[model samples]
Target: MNREAFYKLTYGLYLVSSLRGEKKNGFVSNAVFQVTSNPPQIAVVCNKDNFTSQLIKDSKLFSISVLKKDANPKLFGLFGFKTGATVDKFESVKHITAKTGAPIVVEESLAWFDCELINTFDVGTHNIFVGQIIDSDLLDSESEPFLYSYYRDVKKGKAPKNAPTFIANK
Candidate 1:
């Protein structure tokens, strides 16, 4: 089986965040997608080992911040490469607490969605968190969404080990 075939699947870059009490955490993800339209629902796939995953489970809330094409490279370094347990990822970033109490990253984001976790599914190394969209807003009307293809092909970015699309070196 050619793993490279998976790369053909389109994905968008996003920051998935959740708050457990006063502590909030976020990570860069490409596995977020809309699950339904009528009632408005979305799903985010997070590695079971991710700190943000547990936070989302415990809080029953999450926020998705859609990244723009011109998003800062440092945002990926801080949120994607570093662990939130050891680093304060939101310390210097501009963000706001959503109605669901999840942190919405405003910096370098084109849109934001506040969601209430409705269901969860265990999928081996990752957990799929399905949420009902509680509230959402568009921040930049003119900016184009950041795509995973652009991240890989243009920016030459690599997916973290925990990412669903991560391909280990053979």
Candidate 2:
């Protein structure tokens, strides 16, 4: 069986942000999805070791920022390639604090969601945080959402090792 077949799965690029006390961090992820509509819930998967994960676990809150199709590549590098533990992820990025206290990047986001973590499932190397949407709104209806396939096929972006869909470098 070819592992490349897994690439057929559909995904969308997102920015998952959280706050722990006064500290804030966020990271790029492709494993965000809506799980239910009745209760308005969403799920986001993140590597256990990611700084953003720790913040989510501690704060029990998070915000999802849907990256726009024409988003700056530097924004990806800043959030994905760099470690928030060593640097301030929000230093240069323009964002607003949600009612949940989680920051939402308004710069490249087409929409944003503020959530309250309702449940957590431990998956190997990562945890799936199920959040009940507390608030959400469209930032820019004109801007198209950035899809994972677009990031790979058009932007030529590769997933980092910590990503759920990361294809190991051979």
lDDT against the true structure, per candidate, is 0.94, 0.93
lDDT (tens digit, per residue) of candidate 1 on 1-170 = 99989989999999999988888899999999999998999999999988898899888999999999969999999999998888888899999989988999999999999999999999999999999999999999999999999999999999989999999971
Which ranges of candidate 1 are over 4 A from the true structure?
none
Best candidate, TM-score-wise?
1
Model 1 TM-score on a 0 to 1 scale: 0.98
lDDT of 2 by residue, 1-170 (tens): 89889889999899999999888889999999999999999999999989899999999999999999969998899999887899999999999999998999888889999999999999989999999999999989887899999999887898888998887882
**Span of ten consecutive residues with least summed lDDT in model 2:** 161-170
Q: All candidates' TM-scores?
A: 0.98, 0.97
